[model samples]
Target: MADPAADAVVRQMRDAIMDTDLKLLQAVNTRLELVARLRAYKRSQGMDFVDQAREDWMHRYLAASNRGPLSEEGLHEIYGRLLDLTKAETAEDDPAG
Candidate 1:
């Protein structure tokens, strides 16, 4: 037996979260698409896809830019996963691999 007002509040919060989740999904897909294009350009130039220095720079840059309720560790965790996912997606687009 939930209070009606509380239930409405919960529903409203859930709806907002769902909208944000959809935005995140869209952003990730857009990033993957850009990664695919970069992979193609690298392939044309015979360049290696894995750039460790660039990745390190990216993590540092993101950490510096973050002004957040999210901790540095949390930012690292999320971006680390994103980097892995991006690498995997780019690899999948590689014809030579």
Candidate 2:
């Protein structure tokens, strides 16, 4: 049975979810910009921008801090994708890009 009121509530929640998605997109872009700037500064200082130890620490820290319905695999996937996006957005280091 299709209830109109339930449909309305679902529609409202979907709209809010879509808005959150837009915010995520904006956040990723902001992160990418900041990473690019940091990478440039590190390059000038004769240093490597991508720190493997820091990345490992971040994953551990986030996993410990997370408290939600989000699964461990989902969190790892999102974190990996975020790192990949930031790295791909920055140039000079990746010759293939």
- lDDT per residue, candidate 1, 41-73, as tens digits? 988999987799999999999999999988999
lDDT (Cα, tens digit) per residue for candidate 2, span 1-97:
8976579888898899999999998998899888888888888887887899999999988988889688878889999988987887787564433
Give the whole-model CA lDDT for all candidates, comma-separated. Answer: 0.91, 0.84
For each candidate in turn, give its C-alpha RMSD to the true structure in angstroms.
1.9, 2.8
Winning model by lDDT:
1
Total backbone clashes of candidate 1, pairs 3 or more residues apart or in separate chains: 0
Which residue window of length 10 is worst by lDDT in model 1?
88-97
Rate residue 90 of model 1 by lDDT.
78
- What TM-score does structure 1 among the candidates reach? 0.89
Clashing residue pairs for model 1: none
